[model samples]
Target chain A: MGEKIKVDRVTKTFVVRDSDQKGARKEFTAISNMEFSVKEGEFLTIVGPSGCGKSTLLDLLGGLSTPTKGRILLDGQEIKGPGLDRGTVFQQYALFPWKTARGNIEFGLEAKGIPKREWRAQSDHYLELVGLKSFADRYPHELSGGMKQRVAIARSLAFNPDVLLMDEPFAALDAQTRETLQSELLRIWEKTKKTIIFITHGIDEAVYLGQRVVILSANPGRIKKIVEIPLKHRLADADIRSNPEFVKARHQVWSLLHEDEYAGLYI
Target chain B: MVAISKQVKSAKRLHKLTINPLLALQKLVKQSIVLLLFFVVWEIAPRIGLVDPAFFPAFSEVASAWWNMLLSNELFSHFSASITRSIAGFGLAIAIAIPLGLVIGWYPIARDLLNPILELFRNTAALALLPVFILLLGIGETSKIAIVFFACTWPILLNTIAAVRNVDPLLIKSARSMNISSFSLFYKVILPASIPTMFTGIRMAGTGAILVLIAAEMVGAKEGLGYFITYSQYNFMIPEMYAGILTISILGLIINYGLLALEKRLSRWKQDPTV
Candidate 1:
């Protein structure tokens, strides 16, 4: 596998005015000296506690925000700003409320200057891939949470970006829907072979979905450890959760994240 | 169980046939009865000497006066003149306010420079500036149109600014991540997102245009609904004045409904019945 993304010594600082104290300002370090690398076509998941800067790191990778210290690279080119090379799926399911599911899916394609004649067929394909063919005409407000997320995924995939940056895309969903989407996402990743950087706060999800799970420590967010799951094969069935290797991998990530200071905080 | 199920099915069919139509018919009847009662009282009160006939005319007398004005073409000319002036002023306000609002809302520097001035002018009543407008533009169509423009501009401008600024940040972030060009971003995301709020401002400005125009006419115009009503009052033509007032009310209603229909068409996505 080739190196797809390289995050080298990235640090993000936010300067906030102290509203309670007159003329006082403070600097906050969200992530400090964070470094990681992802291989091409790999499903890499980063799991962390709240405020661990998982989303911030993903933002940097997607070129939505600039790092205060180091830099990120894609295919040996330093990331400067948002581009079509990296497609991001936000936790809020950021489909334009004014557009229907099909329109939302076609948004990035349209931005890429694709011919108008191809937009419908391209959008229809993605909609079908996400199992939302019947709901192509529905607006975001008319869709359920799971359905909205599916549309969001379809939209990002239709753009055919080099990498998919998902920041807790399934966090808002219920348990059953989340599981169903998790399987669907795996199936998509296998078929498309697109590099995915998935960020989540769920330990079970990180182990279940990622080829390598990177556990992040809070308080100036930094990577604590990276664990590689030794599954015999890629998840081909929903019953993988019952396999010994899966449970063991989940427990290993849990203990690492559940250490003294962060104990009792549910992942 | 079978008998109970059969009875329930029959009851459902009965409800669909009778209750639904009965409810709709009842609503129509209720509304008509209220309007009819109002007209009946209006017709009877003045004729029975419940009020002074010089000041208060019966419904029939007002209707006949309205017909007379229509035949003479006096009401039509005044009505058309008022409509044309108001529409011109309202259109000018929309053309200016929307672009200004979009620029100010999008750029912090522009907002900072203009906010104080906007607040100052918005708070000052447009009617209070009629004398100044007349002095500047002279007591002609220009001055009347200017006053209407001033009255309508503030609401549309302020609402548009608020709308553009308050668009969900996540939507913009998502759009930007797709590498959308700035022009496409504004056209596809920002403008559409801000439309509902912008429409609110437009509707307010529409109402404001008519109001300010009528007030300006009342103060110093020779032709308009306001002038027609005031002239009739001065000459003690009570029924003619009532007719003018009714005409103005109907005009306001028509403007409001037209704007409402436009808003509905533009924002059909908002009406999610399933939600």
Candidate 2:
């Protein structure tokens, strides 16, 4: 498979005013010399400790912010700014409070100038895909945390983007709801075959969903290691977590992440 | 099966009790009783000579004066005149303030340039400028309308600026990641998100408009409810004066309710019916 997204020696630095010392500026390196690539149609999960700049890296990939050095390429083209080719799902479930579930999903479609007649069908398809067909009319406030996240996922998917950048999308959900949504996500991924770059701090989640898990360390976050999961069957199948192979793969990711001094701070 | 059937039946009964029409009627009747008692005391106190009749006219006396003015259509003309001036001034304020607020809020440079001037004018009560407005615009409708406009503009303008500036950063980040155009990002995300705050300013401005307009009318005009009250007072027409004062209070109430209804209709999403 061809490389769909490539980060080549990217570095990001932020200049913040020192609150304690007046007129003094401090430079903080969020990430330094980060390099990775996602092949077409690959599910890549990035795991790291808190303050690791995992989110900053995702921001770079999503084209929400530019790197201080190096460049990110999509299909060999340098990414300059945010574009509709990549859709993002936030952990906060940033669905517009003013919009109903279907209206939120149709936001991108409306931005693309899709014919008004086609909006309902396109939104309905993704709502059903996320198992929220009955909740199309509900506002975000009316929906539960899990349901809101599902609507957010469906919203990003409905826009028919080539890449999905999900930032801890299910981290706020309850354990059972998180597991159910993880399987649903895998189902959606299989059906759409869209390349997904998922960010999380959960080792088991990183292993369960990713074909390749990119582990990042804190303190000017850089890739610590990249572990490849060698599951022989679909991850969404029940009892896969009980399989010896799944347990072993999960342990490999956990050990790599735990070796870092900052690992205990997050998980 | 029997337990499941019993649970469903109980749920239906609970829903019925919560939404019962009779319960709603009872609440309304309970509210009206207090108002009726207030009117009863007001009518009896003056009749029984508990207070001087000239100063504390009977409720029936005010009612008959109101009815007489209504029959003569004198009340209608005064009412419509006040309504027209207030509406014109308030509507103009909305048109000017909302756009200015949105622009100033969105652009830091604009905010920096305008904020001091806004603060200065907002702090200076609009009523205090009555003489100056009359001097510049003359004691005509223009001066009255201008003062009302001045009073109504600040709340809306300032609130709009605050609302636009305070939108959640996460919402903006999510919208940006979609690669939506700048215009779409603003109208779709920023505008709707800022609406609740914007409405807050508008409601305040609505009240301000009525208050300022009535005060301005009392000072200069010969038509509005404010003028009617002063005219009746000088003539010692106590009942007519009270009628005019009552009209102002009623007008204020109606304006507040109307704005509230509009706010409620537009912000249906903010309401949590579950609570």
Candidate 1 lDDT, tens digit per residue, B71-151?
A: 999999999989989998998999999999999999999999999999999999999999999999998899988988899
Tens digits of per-residue lDDT for model 2, B38-87: 99999999999998999989999999999999999999999998999999
DockQ for each model: 0.39, 0.46
Docking quality level of the chain pair in candidate 2: acceptable
lDDT of 1 by residue, A1-267 (tens): 999999999999998787888999988899999998999999999999887898889888888899999999999899999988889998999999999999999898898888989999999999989888877887887677788898999999898898999999999988877887898899899999999999998988999889999999887889899999887555565499989889899999988988747466534
Please tell me how candidate 1 rates in CAPRI terms: acceptable
User: Which candidate number would show the highest DockQ if scored against the true structure?
Assistant: 2
Q: Write the per-residue lDDT of candidate 2 for residues A99-199, one digit (tens) a residue.
A: 99999999878866789999999999999898778778988876777788989999888888899999999899888778878888898999999999999
lDDT of 1: 0.90
Report how far residue A257 has shifted in candidate 1, in Å.
Answer: 1.5
